[model samples]
Target: MSDTARTIGVVGAGSIGATVCADLVLHGFRVVLVDRDPAALERARRVVAEAVRFGPMLRPGLPRVGAAEALAGVTTYTALEALGGCEFVVENVSEEWETKRAVYRELDRVLPAGVGIGVNTSSIGIGRLAAETGRPELVVGIHFMNPAYLKEAVEVMRGAETSEACMAYVMGLLADLGKEGIVVGDFPGFVSNRISHLFFNEAARLVEEEGVEPAVIDQIFKRCFGHRMGPLETADLIGLDTVLLTLDSLHESYRDDRFKASAHLRALVADGRLGRKTGAGFHAYGLPAGGTGAAQG
Candidate 1:
């Protein structure tokens, strides 16, 4: 792929979005990353440059993108109108209804007809988000995992009004990235977050109520269940603030007490200790493998 390859618009310059931009750049797609925050965009540029230079060490299958090539593949902007010429756009803004709602409204006007929109959200429903756009059928969910370049599988959610054409376009995009899309139904939290948040919330509650250390809770699941990262550790990686918003979305959507976020988790978000991104939340990106690092447990 060349620098003149198809252009994809990525809204938001957060952790996930910046990583996604790198993945797109690595695959030879010209990416236009949009955010109102110029600082965030600069940070994204640095992150992309670093990932392209060093990310292949962890995943040798990826082509080594040079600084000039990687830089050529991305352009940053502070306006939504910059996305007008993009072939496709992925929205990775904060997990807030009002913020996303406003973005979708502007996207409806900015995007040319026939272009598709991928909603890379955690808990929000594709159908509900598509409702904000004039082309509901063009919206689909693309649940990209952390460190997206390393993830080979992605959960693709189909909105009720999503057209087959839209789904195919998204599938094609994922294929270009050397990723497989596992199609799923449209719903808040969908498959991953719906159940994952429950375990995360419960893990926090156990720490608050039973006084079990966070590390202790994580160890049980890792050693006993044979899972990689424990609930709390995963939550920390995902950002505690994001976890709270996702839990709140789940609770409100289901109207079930089980989905309510734990008070302990809520407090973490309120305090601004949001995981690895902040160098704090969840003991600062959790404990090391086979761990023993007194990380705020």
Candidate 2:
């Protein structure tokens, strides 16, 4: 696809969506970020402004747009119809199936038939979502890591009805965005999530079953496996709610006992220890490193 034909629309302007938009703009693609919440839209605009001011991924000496002008090329819309002419649309909503279905249905009704739709779901079934869109041929799964712009690996999934042209378009697009599109099936918890969850689940099991401290487990993984962050720390950064939801989705899909969400995770959620967002999780914040007496959340 031509660079000018790469007008993209993002349905969620949260962290991931905003990162993607900033990256797209730096790569010369017109982008529109859509969200129902004005606060989310404002956040997206601010993120874009920061990225532009710093020449996000661009050369250090290059001129960058200011806050007001950085968002000029990127429009924020609350209505789905605003995505009508976009060549690609990415959904970044929560993990709920019904919420995604509603967004897909709305996009399918207003978006041009030639436009492609992608979802950022970490564990949901791509085929199921495609079916709900009523345009399976144009629906594909493009999973970018949490920090979308900085991450180079992207999980690209194809549904049963996905067309070859659509796949080619998506792969080519990912390449343009400097990403490695690792193609996977429509199975729930596709490659990365399936493999990574084992590490995270094992970490949780250590805390719940063996009485191992969360910091100790995290330290072992980091020291032994060369992982930058331990599973618990990663979960804290990703939000406990998100981690539990992904695990639950995987469990429902594979019916595997291993994929089950850990009891410790549920307990943390119940106690509102939702990690950094809530001020506490496996470790207490604003304390001497590794203290775990529960700060707030």
Top-scoring candidate (TM-score): 1
Q: Write the per-residue lDDT of candidate 2 for residues 1-297, one digit (tens) a residue.
A: 233446889888764677677767756677888999988787677666666655443434333445565566688988888998788998888777788889888888999778889888879988898888768899999998755655667999888889999999989988887778999998888888898887787888889999999999888878998987888887876667777888988988889999888899889988998776556888766631112222111
Stretches off by above 4 angstroms in model 2 are: 1-5, 50-69, 277-279, 283-297
Candidates' TM-scores? Answer: 0.93, 0.84
Question: How high is the lDDT of residue 161 in model 2?
Answer: 88
- For residues 1-297, write the lDDT of model 1, one tens digit per residue: 563598999999886888889889998889999998998888778777777766777677887889688987889999999999999999999999999999999999999998889999999989998999889999999999877776788999999999999989999999998899999999889999898998999999999899999999889999999998899888887778888988898889899999888888888888888876666766754432112221121
Candidate number of the best lDDT: 1
Candidate 1 shows a clash count of 1
Q: How much is 180 displaced in model 1, in angstroms?
A: 0.9
Could you tell me the lDDT of residue 276 within candidate 2? 64
